[model samples]
Target: MTTDSSDLSQVDEEAKLDLTQQIRDAILGGEFAPHQRLIEADISARFDATRAAVRTALLNLTGEGLVERLPNRGARVRAISVDEAVEIVEVRIGLESLCARKAAVNITDADIEELRGVRAQIEAAVASGHLVEYARLNQEMDRRIRDIGGHETATRLLERLRAQSARHQFRLAFHPGRASQSAPEHIAIIDAVLARDPDAAEAATRAHLEGIVDVLRHLD
Candidate 1:
């Protein structure tokens, strides 16, 4: 039996996608620091991929705003400046508020219950000073709202922006009293959505992220 050409092409595409995701996750997870050089040979060895494959993956990530390709310098993780992070959050305020408004209109009972559970966990994490856990729960809440809203375009844009700004956000998590302040804002968003009030949900989401923009403006 001969393997079809299309089958080979499909396999290659899947492999490329898998490699891309692995590298993207490493960058977002802080395994690769901002602006650190991504030598093709080193990445190939680390991920057991060919240099050509690693190069392709890096180029793909560059388009996603998670990596940068310097002229004659190969590739490295993209470093987002404080101003860029503030801009990203400002954009998110609009997208996330839209999601919250739609979620309020579209959420089912099950979604409400699931979000309430996440809210409780967020409160517990904040009360216990578990910064990392709180950060994770915060992401979970955003993800849940996006899913509930079913806005594919906003979800895609938010994912890229989130990855690009991950470093700034991670740092924000550990800022003094930031979690305490953030928890209440997230809870307000959840409450508004749970109440099925689209206008209130949008306002709460906007207020929550506008506060983030203010904090980012002052971030060292």
Candidate 2:
């Protein structure tokens, strides 16, 4: 991808996000292993970008806790940890529970409809045996919940945690039968939200995440 090409232009609003996302994709896709040092010269070569551009991308990921910067060293992909994974879910529960509560108060009819549509997409992905689609829709469901909730701070908090958890979650999702169960849990959470029941929505969201934590714990 050419740096100045419209598809990868750094001047556009999406350019910066794409750069960070590219780096993230590489790490989470296992193109770079845990604690793998990412030299600016090397990443610049890989991404076909200037050292400065690669630096900016590395800094962004470092801020998200996906990359670590040593005092004299550049950056490296962060290693996963069971303790960190558990804490991440605990933090997500707090933020997502708030989103579920706010979604009950603030979601519109159309938003609820869209959520149902998202659930349907997930079902289709499952039936088609596409785990990738299942994961994408799973993220979308959580995203729409936060969007409908309109809780910016809470959404940002959960989003960061989700990003951090992705490295571990991918492992769990790839495990046999886990991703299949995720869609149903997603639907139940949305069902509670669509019913406009804050209590039920909160409960369902909590249950959904706790279920995920169970699997992550099993990994440990």
Output the number of the TM-score-best candidate. 1
Give candidate 1 regions above 4 Å deviation: none
Candidate 2, residue 110: the lDDT equals: 91
Q: How close is candidate 2 to the true structure, as a TM-score?
A: 0.88
Quote model 1's TM-score. Answer: 0.95
Model 2: lDDT equals: 0.84
Q: What Cα-based lDDT does every candidate model obtain?
A: 0.93, 0.84
TM-score for each prediction? 0.95, 0.88
Predicted candidate 1 versus true structure: per-residue lDDT over 1-220, tens digit per residue: 9999999999988898899999998998899988899999999999999888898899889999999989999888888999999999999988999999999999999998999999999999998988999999999999999999999999999998898898899899998989989899999999999999999999999998899899999987
Clashing pairs in 2: none
